[model samples]
Target: MSTDLSSTPPGSPGAPASDKLDRHVLVIAGVVVLGAIMSILDITVVSVALETFQREFDATTAQVAWTMTAYTLALASVIPLTGWASDRFGTKRLYLIAIVLFSAGSALCAAATSLEMLVAFRVVQGLGGGMLVPLGMTILTRAAGPERLGRVMAVMGVPMLLGPIFGPILGGALIDNASWHWIFLINVPIGVATIVYAAIVLPKDDVEPSETFDWLGMVLLSPGLAAFLYGVSTIPETGTILDAEVLVPAIIGLLLIAAFVPWALSRRNAHPLVDLRLFQNFTLTIAVIAMALFAMAFFGASLLFPLYFQQVRGEGALDAGLLLAPQGLGAMLVMPLAGVLTDRIGPGKIVLVGVAVITVGMGMFATLDAETSYYFLTGALFVMGLGMGATMMPIMTAALQTLRGHTVARGSTLLNIVQQVAASIGTAIFSVLLTNGVKNEADPTALALGEIEDESQLRAFLEQTGIPAEQLPTILRDLTDDLAGVFSGTFWIAAAMVAVVLVPAFFLPRKPPAEPVDQTALMGH
Candidate 1:
């Protein structure tokens, strides 16, 4: 049963002739990429604006933080329903509706007069924003079919990888020159345009209204994810996972997620909101695990980089963001080549090489000091970007290659969920480590300076510490050195974390078949 090479998709063995995506597939991919960029950029852009929001709204740090927290919670809550919604409403229609909702939320956010109102509107935006990426992946998967998934994912990954790199720079520019409201308002036109274009060109897949909605699964999974993420988000602020604020919700969320697995597995005919059975595929399972580890390492290191630039190097937000651009540029340069190579050589070997590169990049970062050259840092970051660009999309493509038909949507959602959780855990763990490292090395007197706002209070604190006013500069210098050392150690931890990916990468299939094998035939379709 030999399959025609021309008919086979790109990832499958035996079909070199069908490697290039059709023009129609390219157009669809372009549209999906547009929405993905808009949504992901929106997430990262708001991060740089948080301080501005706090001051403008006259709110406490915790209160102003809710602007982001609420949005994240909403996103976590809604992601589980995306698979069912896509099936019930059709991918094209649901995608259009999501855009409209996101645009409406953006408009409302721009018009918000109070922090509370802004937080409310952000939740609305999250509802729509959460659906866009998964649905976009689902749509692209079906359109490109299994064979071309690697190339299609590479295209879609452009915004996902670049959004964080450029988001802060854009946000800083907007805040410095214009009002913060523009951050939310900017999404309006993009969303509207995407909606209109998607409505016109997107294929209308048949709606499966008969597909049973797993209400129990939703109740269990959505809140579980939200609570877990919320707890993790609190770690930077609370300083420890043992805090009641972190522990209670995280435990409950874990219990709920654990419960959902068996409940979902026990279901007979109806599909769970996210199918656990997909984990049965060894390749998909390993890919998912690799992705989770990669997310933790990548995101944790990403957080540390900006803070090191800002706090230790004394750079502003925009400068730090620009400095981060080399990594993204590196990723951009390599992604197309990585995609093509993954198709030809299989993902396992590419991933092994990519992870090795990333580990080397992290090792470079781990050796940084306050006086590290800008050129060296830039080159290292670019290498990290190259490694990430080569690694992430291929892992995603590998997972998708193993899925077919209805399973694709659930698989996308599952991957997104794991990524979100992994990033949160990474952020939480690294944040705690950084905080403790700085505290352990910092001078007690210098640390107390942070709390002394008034000149009189500062003098009183200095007198209490029995330090002369003239010696403050020396203490500050020592403090900077300590911070640099702490950040350097943190990068080492990130490197070690990234090294863990090699274990799972080895599990990925080493080579593609020389001849095209019909994916449908292999899957017993």
Candidate 2:
């Protein structure tokens, strides 16, 4: 960022500041933005289509659901290596190639005729897709310099905010009017254009970064997290906790992940995939942990909301997506202000407030009912969005606050990995909870109401459960409403977690005294 060319040889570091204000900034930014949008959308877009995948493949809920987990796992596996890859290659080259790869994966998914093929291709998409978000942050922050980062983040966060909203909406519309294939197909034009634009506008950095890939670390970390998540996903699948097959894989995964710590810490300059040493930076450590937990809570609940609207409230997919739009809009509205405030006040204080509001929002949702008002449900969503808006930038700033220059790239990449892994855990954990409660409660409600008379007995016997008789009449209508509350409980727990995380704020060094802004990186503004 310091335009002083003495330190960085042109070919070694990433794309240096362009000589003039080339259209390349916009080009790279556009590609990065689209990449970010695609990656974010992928996480949620498939939720609506899960049933379709199940029906078409003749798969059970467990089998079809892997479509989501596979993508997430692939993402977690590859994310830690992003910074090293970019540094070794070149940011612009790596970013462009990543987009193309992601698009190709999307195309593969669209062309797939079978369930197995689709899941495999989704993993490919995840591999490339995971690069966009963290790489986007690294590029933007470096591009903007310290002076303009607040505004840059505010502007950039718009697409990031909209991803969750559009995923369901887009999925719903595509499934309704077109078909599931369109969800993946839509990325092609965007990807092609991003590649072309990048080639033209992005500066050519012939950086030959020489470094070794952390094959050993990857061997342990990726499979470890995958096993843990896969095991968690299975709890819901088998509808029981005692499955030894699931338990063994999961426990092994946990042990492997635990082993990665000492393995990574021992590597001095050779960052084995990820540098766990970044945790020593208090600001980044707290930010990553809080965000990881927040994502776990947020994404875990997101899966259930659509199900609630469709299954319990009897709304269509598109309608539910539309209904959910207001919340995202609220987050979009508030994020810019939060960005500005983050710069004026410290990120620590700003994030604290954001986390508090988020907790309140989650608590509000915790009190849902079968006949709650749309305003009540949507309003709670809006508050949660506000929390996301308020929290995202400040928290990002906190992560970057202490890491000066290119070190921020490594921090950003590691931060991204943390959130992805945390989110999968969140989904798996909440899904397991939802499955258990629903399975345990379904039959009792029927029996108590004398609904399982004789033929119904066959269904009960097969289900191996009973529903309370008085609740049997409305059980189908109320299942999602009850599930929503169960998921909300996870949010409340995350909110309470903010208190513990806040303690680390004391250590963030006050904005380095009289810090000079990095003007070369600030060319866009």
Candidate 3:
């Protein structure tokens, strides 16, 4: 409720004056961004190698999936405690510990002989990876202060935006040229370098621990988030939210979260794990809501592009990854400019423009077919990227700019938590939509394909479907049109989700912060 700008120093430790950009700030930002990118890139990189892990360990699909599942759950579980841990230990110390933990986990994952061991190691990796992003954001925000937050976030957003696009490409290259182990092993050098750099450059802040740990809040919120995420993750496999696999954990998680609310609000004796009261700030409230909705649309739609390239276009993983590059490129091109614009005019109008651009891109995707031109598809993706570059970091900077220095860490944690949950929900919802669309279209497609007669035409259909020539007559049928229809339908749904953000975007602040503080002040300088 209080702005209290004068209580803290001008910027974080080693931070420059509020009006200046200096070497120290850039170096610190670079190191933080590198650490964050390593963590995020690891998430998508492992996704591409799941099958490789299964084959190497001689494990079933369900068992091998734990490699990813465990990591996600661990991430969810540890995130709620990040604010407390940072305050208790100091951000620099905690970040270094996280790097060490992640590096060790990666080494163990590479050396693991069994699937179970691999999954366990992934948990360690996840715990460390989970802390990197929110904590990194907190550190960067403190260093940049409100005035320069938009530009600072632009730098930080690069890895966050590009990692998912590039992860599959890197994973495929490693898998084809080397072994699955290389996927995990690759993190070591990056992690070590990040640790060394951070240790040398990152300033040690004075620790201001809360009077007591909020054990009760943690007990409720941690599992609540994990359960909800776990349930959401199962939706693609279960095919519906109503399925017990999705319902049970989700219901329990929601109940626990519901229970935590009253408890946190009542606990005046100690700080809650996350200050739910931050929502009382209207700007912060709108920013969080807009961000959650954007995550659902963005993460959900991300799944569709790769699948479209692989299934409809019959491209391999690496090829599909290459095809998805334009989206990231478009985003990269527009982000720096977007950052400056956001600082000048505020995030509201910028986000509206972004949402509009994304809608156009998604609309184009909805019309895609087997014969759709490569240039058109890439152009649409590029437009979507430009929109995303404008939208994501601006919204984030807006949220952090609204918070007081003491609450920034908790605010960052809350934002990350919402995003993780929203992404899961988005992924689940889109997956179901695509799956159902495919199922509905399959029979009609089979009937149409039954009419194929020309030998060359039938051979081409077989190649596209990846079915045997012998089975083409009785068992296999070309579903190219059907898939195109299904993907297009799903793309429309994604577009619609993105469009919904415009309503909330209008509620954001109309201009930049009225009075900005010194960046170094957040470090208790």
Compute the lDDT of residue 278 as modeled in candidate 2.
69
Which of the predicted structures, 1 or 2, would earn the higher lDDT when compared with the native? 1
Per-residue lDDT, model 3, residue 342, is 73
Clashes of each: 6, 13, 9
Residue by residue across 38-84, what tens digits does model 3's lDDT show?
88888899988888887898888777878988998898889889988
Candidate 1 Cα errors over 4 Å, as ranges? 1-17, 450-466, 513-525
Candidate 2 lDDT over residue span 1-525, tens digit each: 123222445344332343222354454566667778888888778878998998888998878888898887788767777877887887787888789889999999999999999999999999898788878888877665543355456666777777888788988888888998998998888888777877776667566645677777888888887887777667666666579867987899889989888887773435567767767655567778777766676766666666667655768888989888877887888887876555544466666767677777767766766577899989988887887787766667767655655466677888787776666666666667666655555454533333334776656654555434454447644555554555455445545654444545444323421243232243221
User: How much is the lDDT of residue 493 in candidate 3?
Assistant: 85
User: Looking at candidate 3, what is the lDDT of residue 339?
Assistant: 78
- Between prediction 2 and prediction 3, the one with superior TM-score is 3
Residue-level lDDT of model 1, residues 195-303, one tens digit each, is 8789878997787555888988988999999988998899999998889999999999999999899987774625788877777777889999999999998886788
lDDT, residue 5, model 2 = 29
- TM-scores of all candidate predictions against the true structure: 0.94, 0.83, 0.90
Let me know the TM-score candidate 2 reaches against the reference structure.
0.83
